[model samples]
Target chain A: TPFRIQNYRTLAYVLTTLVYLVIGAAIFDRLESTQESISYANLQTRIDVFRQQHNMSKSEFENLTRTVESRLNYRKKQWKFIGSFYYATVVLALVGYGHAIPYTKAGRAVTIAYALIGIPMWLIMIQSVGERLNSLITFVLKRIKRHFKRKREPQITAMELLTCEALLTVLTLATGSYVFHRYENWRYFDAFYYCLLTLTTIGFGDLVPMQKDDYGSIGWLYILFCIMFILTGLTIVASSGNLLILRFVETNTKRSRNERYEM
Target chain B: TPFRIQNYRTLAYVLTTLVYLVIGAAIFDRLESTQESISYANLQTRIDVFRQQHNMSKSEFENLTRTVESRLNYRKKQWKFIGSFYYATVVLALVGYGHAIPYTKAGRAVTIAYALIGIPMWLIMIQSVGERLNSLITFVLKRIKRHFKRKREPQITAMELLTCEALLTVLTLATGSYVFHRYENWRYFDAFYYCLLTLTTIGFGDLVPMQKDDYGSIGWLYILFCIMFILTGLTIVASSGNLLILRFVETNTKRSRNERYEM
Candidate 1:
């Protein structure tokens, strides 16, 4: 009974994970095969031949699988984090990307409601956690500095930080537009347009850069810029928005206590 | 000038959003035109018609657009606070969901990297956040009870909360397997497989619940259960994972203080 309770669950979880992998593969393969001349049979045969050439031991094969899996797992976590951020940003970044997924009528209705409530809820939640984490991170960093270097702390309050972030947002948004104009084959407005779309991660595919032959040379540059944009966006959230919420929470809790005392 | 700056930025963001919508419609229309049985002139006419539908009046559209945009912005500011928790939870919630958008090799590389780092981070982060949120949630709830209802507080400690979660993890995995077996339409593994995948919002499409079924009887129930599963999963991350991290941080901070004093 105990064994079934534990091992059964482990088995279920593993199988569940594998099913996800297979489904992902099926969708990807189907799409890829549709776009290319490769047959599923040929792909399988290629895998078989490749496996034979390696002639890997069962243990070796498993180790290789695990290595590949670990890599996949890592990527999943990163994207999920990023993607969750992306979804949250779209909903809460006040950008209103309006790209909520709704594949059916019922789903659409729910999505509309989700957009109404879920977006705000997510925004609040993100802000709350972001502030708390920042405090935790900053607190740790300060201690390390004090312990080792004994550096004099030049105090910059949270208000100053907010103003700096607002300026950064405008600058980053403007720079994003400029890059879209300069490197890619877009008109100035279109460049600004593309920057907004991509940074927002709406990824409308209308003016996606680095795809045309001339612009293709800077593909990696575009990707790097995207990563930077995302990180910068995160910094903005981590700083001002989070601080506001934490202050609100602390203020409310204190106000409640004071009111109780007065009563 | 302040008003003008806000107006211009708002317009820029809006115009950019519209460009995507119009362009998206144009792309689809042109594609449809190419595949049509009608004459090229008629096809061109149809494409123009589609564009007309997507175009917006400057005055009339602006106010409504701003309404939604402003609301979304308010939400975004709020969300930016706690967004980190979601980001972290998503990274390591579960591992190896296979949904990918491989536009280029570099994109693929980033995707691959995400799989490697993001998966464990997702799990670890979720576990960490869940612990903290759970403790805080319980702690607050108990305190509220003490304040309002004058009830004795439940001793909801960290270890107990964590043990319960670990037990749930095994339960989820096992329940997934047994459910897969009962369904039998899915392979013995795929049902439990997608439970984790979808629960985590990886939505890799390798497996989906009731993939080929009509919503004859249990449609609402199915959707409801899925929602419940996801919410519970989130609760786990909020309570268990976050609390543990906070505790770790507190311990380390304290440890260093002791060290500094000793030195």
Candidate 2:
């Protein structure tokens, strides 16, 4: 029924993911253009102003570029570290590392406040992920029930679970290699590695595929590549998420039966 | 029989996750201290450093403090933006943006090489997550078989799923809020926001709660939280994985039969 609780919830999840994905893509695309502009005349103007203010000669200007480059490099590495810190924190989901922000009291106050807003935002996200999962679980359970309804040992040996593993490997390999080919010249093993990292989202940023020489022309293609990568990542996570839910139900069910029998 | 494959795999998962949590916590604690030291000089030495670097009078120093404070505010916000970028890259499991790294051809080459390395590193991780998932699936399928082997249906229903959800929620909340309270004076909601972000690894770092405080004082506690939160996440994923496996097995069984009948 259109109003069934599960159906309604599934509809909501579909709509939300679709909406968020579109919004996210839009924002990413806008940012990509903004980043492009940051290098255009505006940034050149800012550099010229800074150099003039410093009363720099051409040689001094070059020296200053070296110094600035060094500083930028240092900052790049530092910021990358911070970025990695963010990656780790999020993966660990601790959200406690303050290296990404101020450590002062006023800063802390704002941080605390932002966190208050962020918490529920995350909770909403979790609920959405859970709802998606619930829908999936419902879908799977129904399928199993239908199979068992046939009322036979059904000539199915469960060892075929290994076959699923085989299928997963093949799929992972095929998809991984294709992505790798488009982004890099990795061998099969390396392609598999890229797939692993991208799918899992470890995202060290140490191993990102660099932006190609767009020659200012491939920007749209690059954007498309990124957006496609994000969607592919969601699929991998969704599949992995599906696997994780299966284990949870199994463990809990056993624990409960054990407790009851013991009682 | 003494060393069942399923049991061994579960043990491996627990051990790997346990080890990763330890290393993750240790690194974070050290990083916190290093970052805290960046602004430190003891209150007395601070005067000397300020005098030495910029040659400021007390009044001038105080005035300069305003500039520094404003700069810090800007930096904090900027860092949070960077952190958010890193997070977006991580969760999507694909780093597309070139914020803190090279965007040139040389840079792309580096990224490609780096990705080649990163992919396998990620694969190893997937294998670990995969192992845990496999055991969990086998464990659940065994249960389902026994469940149907019985004369009664055991009243399988949605209520049972709630029990798992409750555990996941509690486990997340307990670890999340505690770590949040570690460095920030956030309300419980703030703590919760921090927790949800951390668990899901969405990691919008605008509200980092710890670091620059307590170093090793709560090191063990921090580690414990990481272990618990991720385990809970993994467990939830496992439950769904089990359901999907069952469904897949059923579908394949049916499809193969249908093809044979048509033939």
Candidate 3:
């Protein structure tokens, strides 16, 4: 019942994050659209002035304007609903995949304001879920230890604990690589690399998954699962690292104290 | 002497991180160049084949190929030495601005490998510096408290501590916003937003500072300072948040336990 209560709290947090994201996307969309229209108008005026100043022929002006319009349209198309949502996800998750940027002052302002709230909320949500996963991991590890105790091996050393954590990390990476390679049509190495990048939260966006329209809903689901996997893996890695560092510091301090006593 | 020793360790860590970044950039540069050449060759072959199959005129093919070449050149231009260094910083810091991404399989693999080592190292480095900063903050706060004590207000409450932290955060944001607004030629709100996004490590790259060529060496220095500022700000914010959260959680648990006891 306590775990269930925590789960409900997590669900609430998740819902709140989603709501924040949707609101961000809508605001971004409107802000960007307004900026785009203003820029387009400015461009139009500049083009008109240039044509008039140069006494350009109608056909020449039309050709130049068409080229400009096409370029603008291409830029505009990059901010569609899905793309905007992706941008929102990138910002909230602190990935900042600069594929599509907000060009307007208001858009940039809102982005800063949005991220100020969204990032902390997102972190809290991830940390909450991560804590749960951490407990699950600990429980699983303990069960394995118990099973081993039944076979007459009872003690678990620090090294053994580290190895287990490392093994889990490797397993998670391997599974992610396999699934992404299958779905994203990427090489094994690339998939593995992608898993590492996303898990580390160093999302370069060069090898992002599910960018294709064909993948659709499944792609979104995959991304969601990947986020969970990444968070859990990070928690394990960080905890292990902290343990190691603490041991290192302790040993150093003890050795120095002994040296000082001898002196 | 311990503080001195720690400072030395921090310096060593900073140097090592820089070395790691440089090496990563070099390797990524090479990997990406190889991939680019191969892709260009492939594109050239495809274009030739298409022209041959379509029985296109030489002039028409040349025109088309020139257009394609220009596009490729534009893409290539995004990966200059400085830009790549910036990219490496983005990756290692887990900011991943996605402005300059590794396109090659080898480059991506290296990036993953590099980040696996680099992210933890960066975290350690940030935290090392952060701890120093934290102590400095504590010292400063104590001095401020003592000053108030001299003015006959000796008692310091949790609210006062919280207020002090909040004030520091706001002051940092305001100062950063002013400096960036002046340097980046952005609106005040946009500058503040940029500060928030970056300090939170949600670097959307929509409004990055020190991006103009005119800013030159000064721009680079500004960026370097900004990174330091962001790291320090993050450490302060995280610690303050943690303290607040811990207190909140403790109170909540106490209240819940009391309710259960009453029931």
Candidate 4:
């Protein structure tokens, strides 16, 4: 019966998520579909004007458009050493920005092989670091409590660690946004969006940083900083998520075990 | 000392992974960079020829190219109800195909808010489903073993479970590839690559499905099937990864605890 209850509970969660996704889909469609149509029409008009200006036939215009589109996609040098390294990190992190994807068949094959091993390795590494970070935070919290001469021995609860992680996440986002704003010359809001997307690993690539041909100077430093920022931010979030999920599963298992004992 | 050793081992893993990434980057660069340059040059030549043929000035051609690129990006109707649902699933999974990202500021803002809550909830739900899947497989394997009437009790080992999971994953890939190959008209290899990328959640949108306006009569069926395939594939992979990481962490923790006890 407990097993059945657990299955039922999971089913409920799945149903709820489906509803949530539907609501989100509706909201996104409402906010974006009209804008998408307006923009699409504007682009169509522009293409039509260009065709008329050149006295070009439909087939000729289509051919030129195909050529120009492919050319525009590669305007930036995305396969150089540094960019390639960036691509490697993105793949390992499962961020897959699509800004600099593998263009050749061999590249795709290698990507598949590389990701098969790299992703799990990366996950373990980040999560290992995250656990350590959690311990370090817990130790520091305990010391702070001791310094305050608290009446209790100051055992750090999961809730406390969670709050600490949440704070660190916000701090990381704020600092990351400011840094990207300065380096990438994006508006602050856009930079914040970029940082959030990267941390979540959603990485839509709409506003990827380090994309310009010229980073002025200290480009390597900026790139290194960005990579480190991504790694470190994910660790913090992983720690937080780890705590949340483990506590959740632990509670559920404990409840079910107790119920079984009662039965 | 054991604590220090654990830290050192984690550090070693981190360093090794860095080296691995560097090697991969070199390989990818070597494999793909020359092609990139060749393609880039070819595109440039075509653009130049087109500009000269049209007697278009530099600025005029630049403006036209920008409009064409923007227009080309939206040739697909990616904001319809079904497409939006697909988009929602991608974001929630953090696959982020980027085929149909939010256009308006409101959409982006809502996306941020939605992901903040939805991502963790989705993670928990998927992991729960994955755990159940794992248990179900183990149960079935035990049942099959008992049917053979072995001398010893049919105990399902972790290794056995792992092998089963691997076989299931490969089978999922094979069948998924075939189905997508039939439906989306992609080459078999490309369909396999799509399945691999989707399962890894490193969804490079270069070969996203459902892009064509004409999906024949069973378009909705195809869409539903694709979504189900993605979810099931991810759940299987998550189950495998979960077993792996938990076993790894358990062994490490056991060893360290034993070392502490010895001290």
Interface C-alpha root-mean-square deviation of candidate 1: 22.9
Q: Scored by CA lDDT, what does every candidate get?
A: 0.42, 0.41, 0.54, 0.83
Please write out the lDDT profile of model 2 over residues B58-152, one tens digit for every residue. 77544434433322322222113323333232333232321233323333343445444443333223333433344343445446746777734
lDDT of 4 by residue, B1-263 (tens): 76677667768878988998899889888988999999988887887888899898989888878888797779887887877888889999999988887878888888899998898888778877777777778778877888897635677788898899999999999999998999889999899999999999988888898888877899888888888887888889888876887667556546655342121
The residue-by-residue lDDT of candidate 3 on A85-124, one tens digit each, is: 5555666666665555564554565566656655555544
Segments in model 4 whose C-alpha atoms lie over 4 Å from true places: A150-154, A252-263, B150-153, B253-263
Share of native interface contacts recovered by each model? 0.00, 0.04, 0.21, 0.62
Instruction: Provide the TM-score of chain B versus the true chain B for each model in turn.
Output: 0.36, 0.39, 0.56, 0.92
Q: Give me the candidate number with maximum lDDT.
A: 4
* Model 1, span B26-112: residue lDDT tens: 433333323222333453454345335535344433332333232221221111212222222222333112222232333333333
User: Against the hidden reference, what TM-scores do the models get?
Assistant: 0.37, 0.34, 0.59, 0.94
Positional deviation of residue B167's Cα in model 4 after best superposition, in angstroms:
1.9
Per-prediction backbone clash count: 60, 27, 0, 0
lDDT, candidate 4, A13-107, per-residue tens = 88988999999889888888999999999888887887887899999888877887787679788888878888999999998889997878889
State residue B61's C-alpha deviation in candidate 2, in Å. Answer: 23
Worst 10 residues of 3 chain B by lDDT: B254-263
